[model samples]
Target: MTQIATIIGGGVIGGGWAARFLLAGWDVRVFDPDPEAQRKIGEVLDNARAALPGLYDMPMPAEGALSFHDRLEDAVQGASWIQESVPERLDLKHRVYRDIQAVCDPAAVIGSSTSGFKPSQLQEGATRAEQIVVCHPFNPVYLLPLIEVVGTPANAQMVDGVADTLRGIGMFPLLVRKEIDAHIADRFLEAVWREALWLVKDDIATTEEIDEAIRMGFGLRWAQMGLFETFRIAGGEAGMRHFIDQFGPCLSWPWTRLMDVPEMTDALAQKIADQSDAQSGQHSIRELERHRDANLVGMLRTLKARDWGAGAVLKGHDKTLQAAGRIADTLSDIADPARPVLTVDRAVPLDWTDYNGHMNEARYLQAFGDATDRLMQIVGCTPEYIANGGSYFTAETHIRHLDEVRAGARIRIETQVLSGAGKTMHLFHTMYEGDRALATGEHMLIHVSLETRRASVPAPQVAEPLARLAKAHDSLPRPEGAGAAIGKR
Candidate 1:
């Protein structure tokens, strides 16, 4: 079945939604009146393309097509899901919803990406209003996994399906139990925003200071464990109740004016704009975005190792990705019996380059590791199978660097299964940029019982595929330096 998603606006949030759904293999139709909406969305998609795939070890679903529609009716015609992200105006939203209601598929679920409006507010005077829910997302939605799903009880049940769809695109759907003026995350953010504004208005701190306070402190903790868990840890093993009991009284102090609101005069807005520029004027927005993305990717990847918070979500999703075989085109699926398998074809990003403006030594190993992982999948030692405790562990690896690969150089790895008849599987990989071979690696791996953490013969399921692949490669002539590369013949 072809799943279709519709976006009724092409602003940041809408563009992000388009990227998310489109990348997840849903045909996406977008409608917006702005002349530059497509261009803007294109830019977002570019950023998304560069950042998203790096987050996963497994290949993502082949990208679904994205199209822009001039008419709202055209956009929502075949949509299984319709998301409205127009400017935050009740009348405008209601109009868009009406337009959508007339043309949208009868079974399509409706979501409005409004930060200020509750689901009840958005559903007002709209046809099939019971299906309208507020599906608020943060900025850079493609990177951030959180989405706050809010709806009235009567219509809230429909949101579960919406949550499932969001999950398919690697988003974490946070259900807001009750519809309120600003859903949960924003409410917390608004409180912090108010405090920050006061800090600025009072001349107590600069915008940079406030941001540093976040990125340096609670922000790091929140990214992984969130508030309650951090606080629970602060309780020194006594847990939540004890922590709350200990800190309850401090909450009564005048440390913050949570109820206070600052008047936003033109002068105040100018002050903020000026302060923001002063804080980060050195870097262009794109540069900053790339910097932010690099840090986030590094942080998230590290967290993946520990299986905590956002990392946990990413890790879980990668399993779903591997299980689905979402990418479809694996090296083995397209290999020729006459040639080595083309297991990896990717560009070395700027971040992967070293100080010499060439691909770093460790990255060469990582790329080969990615190729090895793909090989593991072809031979049935997939993430799921490995979870059951049988897989190959590298016992020895010898790499020869013949040339340097610079940043943004598209590289490929062709692998030959040298031998795979027993507990030991020997493989060879050569990295290339076009016809130029840059490096070669000879790897010797031993089948391991993950439960025992030692070498053991693999089960019939894995062994059979490994043997088949080895047999297929047995006739290929061995490349030069086979004996010198890894020593053992």
Candidate 2:
């Protein structure tokens, strides 16, 4: 059964929440009085649809239904989760909560995308105080995984459920131990934001210069290792204590106006706006969003490859998605053994295309390689088996590029096991976009003993299943381009 999520506002943050929930297969109903709410949310969804699915190698769940409601009561009727993203005014939040609790399920989770207000504040005067919690997410909520979940001790179980729901949608829920103003990440961000404002006021750096200082320097380190871990490495052989002892004395220096707030006078505000306009005003906001999304996808893919930091979160989400039946799990899951096995089903990521405005030649091999890996896993050559000293090594490969493919295109690969006997496994893989053939790859692989680094016989566990697949595939018509050498066609 599809779950329902209600959005109380349809601005950037609210739309992001809607997109995240909808893409994760939850039916979303939105209530926003703004006449243009649907159009605005549609724009955000467009950006999300292009970017989010590319993060995974497997298929995302089919998007859920989205409906805009004029009445607040209608929107919250049967919703399991209600997210309030209204402007940051306590009285307004209290009013919204009163209206929500009147119609929403009493047991439903009411989450606030409040950056500063605590749950206790949001729950004040509400019919059900325990239902509300702070589920503050970063901008571009569909991409960035961090969500600060703040609730009082009385709301502990509700907070846990909120975290589990967030993880289901590929989000990292950092439960705030103590409900505080601005939660955890925002407090750190506020400090930096305050200092950045002062630097611009003092003429020390322009907006672009400040951004450059971050994206070009500590920001990269922060992306993968974060603050303390990065600093621990900076400590050299002694670790955190030694580095802090040496650099801690500099805390007393007058290098920053961290505690001081620069007055945002009209003149100062204009100056900053003018500088920012000069820095990045050439591109439209949507273009800038696309650029940021592409860069983020690339960086996140790197981390996912290494299984570090935010990348680890993405990796774990992929496993969760796979377990949810996005892909075939075992030989029995294949519906028709007479046909080739469906091995890969995913969208081409933005990074896979090049200056040619088409999928790069190398990415074809990468996709085919993934298909081969999937087939290996299906026939009992799983990660655990490989770890125990048995795996396939590609000895030779032939690829034929049949048609052009581009980023954001959904593609699939079907594999035919031509032969699987003794120490060798030969595979014929065909790539497709819908029903159109995009490419084909023929590969010859040898089962190897990882310990001796030499070709070796397969274990019975792997051999029997692979042999069965090969026998099943033998009755099917041979692939058209299976044996053709390069340039022969």
Specify the highest-lDDT model's number.
Answer: 2
lDDT of each: 0.83, 0.92
RMSD after CA superposition, every candidate: 3.9, 1.9
Worst 10 residues of 1 by lDDT: 326-335
7, model 2: CA deviation in Å? Answer: 1.2
Could you give candidate 2's per-residue lDDT for residues 286-404 as a string of tens digits? 89999999999999999999999999999999999888754676788888877899999988998999998799988999999999999998898999999899999998899999999
TM-score, predicted candidate 1 vs. hidden true structure: 0.86
- What is the alpha-carbon RMSD of candidate 2 to the true structure? 1.9
TM-score of 2: 0.96
- Candidate 2, residue 343: the lDDT equals 93
- What is the TM-score of each predicted model, taking all chains together? 0.86, 0.96
Judged by lDDT against the true structure, how good is candidate 2? 0.92
Local error of candidate 1 at residue 435 (angstroms): 9.4
